[model samples]
Target: MQINVSTRHGHLSSESRARIVRKVEKLERYFERLTSIEVTVDLEHEESPTVDLRVSAEHKHDFVATGRASTLAASLDVAIGKLEQQLRKYKEKVQNRHRTSGRGAGEVPSLAEREAPDVDAEDEEI
Candidate 1:
């Protein structure tokens, strides 16, 4: 997956960028088709650091998560956790779609098929 890390209103050290890459790479285990990941770190305020994470996958909707904390690593961790939850939900939905696509081995009768006909037996006058 392609990873792009950028800092807004501040400078990020090389070590910090590497750490972010390592953490983001772990997401691939949840979703293999991930095409690209974008991480934006905003350090305008020294006390609070904000991290914006966006992940794109093949033939699927993109996932985005935002987190704010006292440190950059903490914020990244929070955002990553949110993204992991989204990926798991997406995986479950896709799996269920395939599982429900067709009928099972046994055929179940519908309500109309289960009901008896309403024909009257004593209709000799007709």
Candidate 2:
């Protein structure tokens, strides 16, 4: 997946940038088909930093999470946790949908079998 990191009103240290990249890369374990991830860090105050994460996946809506904390890493951790929850929830929903959509194998009769019953009906009185 492609990850783009940007900072607003502050500069990101190389070490911090590397840490963010590593943490974001771990998200692939949750969703294999993720297409891209955008990370935006905004320093609105000297002590509090806000982190925004947007993750795009194939055949699914984007997942977004935002966090504010005293440290950039803390904010990022909170946002990543939120994203993981969303991914888990979405995966459950999709699995449940597919599971509930069809009858169990061998429970449904073929079209020709159903028609055979109708053909025998003409030999008896309704």
Strongest candidate by TM-score: 1
TM-score, predicted candidate 1 vs. hidden true structure: 0.81
Off by over 4 Å in 2: 104-126
**Model 1: which residue pairs collide?**
none
Model 1 lDDT, residue 6, Cα: 94
TM-score of each: 0.81, 0.79
Query: What root-mean-square deviation over C-alphas does model 1 reach?
Result: 6.2
Give Cα-based local distance difference scores for all models: 0.92, 0.90
64 in model 1: Cα distance from truth in Å? 0.3
TM-score of candidate 2 to 2 decimals: 0.79
Per-residue lDDT tens digits of candidate 2, residues 1-126?
899999999999989989999999999888788999999999867698999999999986799999888989899999999999999888888888897687776688888888675656777865
Clashes in predicted model 2: 0
lDDT of 1: 0.92
